[model samples]
Target: MDAPDTAPGTPQAESLEVLYQSPGLPRWRLPPALAALYGSDLGFTEPCLYANFVASLDGVVALGPEYRHSGSTISGREPADRFTMGLLRACADAVVIGAGTLRASPRHHWTPQHVHPSGAADFAELRRRRGRAADPELVVVTARGALPADHPALQTGALVITTATVAAHLRSSLPASCTILAAGQGPALSMREVLDAVHNRGHRVLLTEGGPYLVGQFIAGGLLDELFLTTAPVLAGRIDAARPGLIAGQEFLPALRHPASLASVRRHASYLFLRYQFHRSITDASDILP
Candidate 1:
């Protein structure tokens, strides 16, 4: 691969080493620097819902609730991983997260520049070429409406989706930039309803950074289309039931199986970036599971 035609004064890092990429993946126009750093251009199907996560070699995505910023810890803040995250955020119309994720990541801003600043200009350029806003809108999903009102990300502005009761309460306290949408009435909102609301807002390409439980909802609802996982070369041994893998709040081992096709693979030193495409139509497990 050739060196990226990075712009002047752009901070440079080791580009992602592409090990394998399946043919026929969608391609988008990326700035030269981004294309070079990412090892290729990236794109997504419109109305697509995708997820991103960094897990330990032992498949631990979170280190229980005692640790803060588990993803950064798990990935060791690998530049290539951050670059991939920024690239994905740059490609989306909205970045969605669950309330638990928001609470866990108190200081995070789900923006392309926030995760990977070196490619700020290039990310902005890509968004412009794709006709997106200066920054992808942030969407937070909450079933109970529990959220930190003063969280910086919330202060920065986000679309908060919750039940009617929660919406009524959050609308009064959250920042003026936040929009509260009432989607359902219950302990949990259906992932389908959440995606429908997001789509209605004209977000064709959605990126979910929600936690395992939320991702499980998407998987259970068959809403997620793809997943980008970065496997850090570290083992987070599971002690009891605290450590959770990529999915939580649901099980799909013996009774049901949802397989993913390898779409691409890249390497950044010890970290391995893997892209997977889910092809099966996985509906509610409640209907299929006994």
Candidate 2:
């Protein structure tokens, strides 16, 4: 090339900033109607759900026995990951997960039993300001159909998703209050089928808070649409073998498929938070995530 056009004396910060950005990553934002589907609870008629999770720098989504339960002090909370999850549920038709996940992180029901939930009490006013609704359906997806209906989470009436095989394996005395949707010939319901079922229910905007296996299944099956991953400044570690947390051997960016393009980043405490849309052929594909 010829002599450099911009030198130390030149201000090419804007030009150089563009180079650091990824190809499929969203650079210019979508108008409110398009990309705003996540934050706003109303726009989605069947908009794929928002699945949020936080991990240490090592990408360890979970640690110890509690799944995604890294002391609420991590990126997820301190910033209200619990409430964020609750709000997501508040707007969801269902919350989804796998059989193994239920045995792992396992939500014992934190929301109130009333289905309408008293109109968000505090969050309803805030949601109205953002042009989204404060109401949603609550559900749980598991393979074993083991979440006791008497548990606080399910006691409130969130439906449960599982498989025919798993249901057969479930405790015979399982509570009748639990609405279980049995899946294919196998114990685990295919992710695709679950999404379709939720769509029919009118969640429109779904949110999936996950354990590692569920996250892996979504990525491997290519259904991940938008990812909200929070990276804490520390590492979970490499010595432990069994409790390796979410996506241990799983891939975050599959080379063969479309890349996970960055949508935005925010800072919390000492952590870095990012939102990325699954860039490429699968943003709204029904089989994956429409």
Candidate 3:
């Protein structure tokens, strides 16, 4: 079904231009509701993990305390970016995010309909066709279990992947609707365990919308497979020590320079959408094994 342009001032999807795509990348038109925003289908297979993020031209993902959500600030609540996010969520089995990301957007719901209300029915139909749940399961990862229990997203129910110690602390704090998974015994949570827990729950197509630190852990553990980044045209210059880039709390400079190959590129106006697939060497693959 085609999603009409019901929202005023929202950019149409037909405006998007495909610049480049890898040789073997699958290509197909999206459903009518999403076709305007996303021209091609993102035919992701099961047991895959991908991350999505938006940053400014100055490589700043967060604008410190001055801006509530650096992404919204950087993208200026661009309709194309939101549509892309919604489209990704629509194609995923589950939506994952760090606790920091949950706290950052108090009113945000990590669902396709929340971002693109016009495509709500279309998203539902897509989920039905894929044999997925009506809404993608929300998975929140926290090492310390420090989360806003009363947040609307938690109220709707979520799987809290955390450490055993933190899980006990959160048992009574979080609503009964929220299920806590003790992915680790110690004070820290393991990225591998988190993926295992999600995979065990039958969510093989995982999409992580991170807060940098979580993305860094996924990269550090060599668990990340692909990265879908939206480069906003604005330049959010860093004026303080708090502004962060795409990856935080981890360095991959000299020892772990993870290499990735460009998979696809698209553009809408001044915004650029890029997809990079991480190239995992045999050595890196063995390092992540149990």
Candidate 4:
């Protein structure tokens, strides 16, 4: 990392500037234009569980329940960030999200082309080279089975992982394209079971944009391998506990602290694109959950 910015008259509106990168990162073949815009190629190891998020400088990932789609507000819809999102999606075998996230963005589609239309052809080419499908499958994790049946992402098709009790109801309510995977019989499903189910479906490289609560469960279970965080140039003030940070619904600061190494860093003006690698500790999700 720590490379200079691209020269003027590039195809993209903005290009990422490489600030720092650790040695020996896994990289896949990227389209020339995509690599140029990203300042580098990107890839992940097989059977990887990674997350992507855009947070404010003060580390507020969600504004509040009142604010719908706050991530766009946090990033101001930066072109570089969008392109990075598309790139990540293109590299994943499946894009995972929580039910709340699916409900919050009713019109959103979890695909590479949806986020960055300019890179559609490039992303498709990259996926073709990787022998991936035209689009990554969408996976929605929910225990309560509270989802918008008419959501476009659902109509397009998704894997709804939920409790056994809820799966029956969703099968009748959700669209035919949506596949239901009954994980367990409880108010909450274990993250390990969810990943195992995804793995059984032949999705080795998984990307999650499932908001803070679901991500907290992943971290609590030591299931997350890498985190791609975008530090947008803004501070979201918190008046109450309604606003959540990058991790919520679980605390791990005093007794159990999870450390991560900075894998890479890139920048687009004031926005900082940071990648961190975390080591998995617990063998099973039951180790963390009671």
Candidate 5:
């Protein structure tokens, strides 16, 4: 959705621009909802309920190992993207992920000191702002129970929502802090069920860092509130390949009186980031927020 325009000459609005203009640390830029979080006037909840993520021109997600495939050592470019990816970690009360994604790019809720500059990563403070007294929760959905017990992410604890009918042996090996939340065995824990659980725990702004299938399901289910898309200048040339686009099956944007709306398309050098708010109530992806 298009965020309300910031008033002219205000430091609040400036923070939004300064963050976007900053060259490095992709996760450091402030989100448009920042003002609402700190400002009054709007009731209590974030003005909107949503989730967003950054993907390559080819739609490659950077949640884990594939990030290296996109070139991490490219000097100035990678840091901004990395920071942008990590920044989402701070935005959500709980981060939702698929088992395939977690196994592929295992992550910790808090970026450890060794992973980031000594004083930069603050998991404790971010959670407090969300009204969470402890570390952010990790929601991992798996059809089959296969998460490893020794993965570094366990130290802070996690909620494993699976449909395998039983918990894995890893549950026994892990610390007593972990909890396995069973959400049936169908689509496993339905997206609605998971969101309801997290929302009750004080998270109104949930961010879904996708692994394609998961993104596709949310889009198909009409559960996606908004999307933050960053388009880089370079092209990966997948147009002729005939590979699947977005989701594999047959969900397409329908034609509507106002089918699609473009919120804000901002240019930073050669690249442009465009946000589209899906009006799924009409069952149309084209109906973006103008």
Candidate 6:
């Protein structure tokens, strides 16, 4: 599919068409002015975790060997997608990403303004109104403490969640501005422990921009509450072994399938934005049967 015109000022002022929305779900649409979309309407009373990703029409999240940042290949740096990512970051108290994701985007700063510069002022206003920090705290999960220490995001100071062994290893390597949270005793970090640590810091709205494997851990632990997925019209046919789908390195058995309810859908030219809310009972790990 051909990409829509992404001229400097046109996309930020265009409204996305709402082709279909689930019944009783919010009827919100992306405003032309890039004003806060669904501002403060989420009503998240406690720590709620949500993830966002862009994938090809055939469900491939990454294009192997072609792009360093897989998401860029899928979305092709679409303006609407960037705006939506910014809006989600504006609503979040923290933006969680894996060490691999941080390594992929060397220049990315997990802030709303960084992705959507046109809506910088609006994003700041939203944060101010919500009484959030100047920028969402960057939460980087790494079990082995292996990270790109010189990356820009790390230089900006982030919360590195990892195992105790990794924390000790990172103490002398990571930037002084970075803080470490030992979420596990050994090599593996538990998703539940990471969420507890995040919640302890008073972050109620958490947003994750994952690199598939990390997302798989959240799914396995039943910690993912919602997902915001952008389906680009193009097909990225992947025959390589390295390419991955939305969820990787994990599989749900037939009896353990976790179904998600369609929350909303919006269209921008040929692209489709989808919001899916997973069943609460299934997402709570304690409620799941072995």
lDDT of 4 by residue, 101-132 (tens): 88888788888877777789999999999998
When sorted by lDDT, best at the front, the candidate numbers are 4, 1, 3, 6, 2, 5
C-alpha TM-scores of all predictions: 0.93, 0.66, 0.91, 0.93, 0.64, 0.88
User: What is the model-wide C-alpha lDDT for candidate 1?
Assistant: 0.82
Best by TM-score: 4
lDDT of 6: 0.75
Clashes of each: 0, 11, 2, 1, 9, 0
Highest lDDT against the true fold, candidate: 4
Tens digits of per-residue lDDT, candidate 5, 1-290, equal 10111123322111122223212211322333432221211111242334444444665334233343232222124223333334444555666666655555444343312122321334344545546545346666665666766556655677776643655544665567677765555534465565666666666766665455666666655666666665555534443443333443335545422233454454444445555566656543421111
Model 2 lDDT, residue 254, Cα: 46
TM-score of 4: 0.93
Query: Which digits, one per residue and each the tens of the lDDT, describe model 6 over residues 1-290?
Result: 11112235534524556666565643323343554333213334345788898989998887663467677667878878887887888888999988777777777789887777788887787777778888999999888677988988899899998888879989899999999989888656778888899989899899999678887888877788889899998888856467788877776776578889887788777988888988655553431111
Rate residue 259 of model 5 by lDDT.
34
Quote the positional error of residue 89 for candidate 6 in Å: 0.6
86 in model 4: Cα distance from truth in Å? 0.7
Report, for every candidate in turn, its global Cα lDDT versus the true structure: 0.82, 0.48, 0.78, 0.84, 0.46, 0.75
**Residue pairs in steric clash, candidate 4?**
2-19
> Model 5 lDDT vs. the true structure?
0.46
Candidate 5 clashes: the total is 9
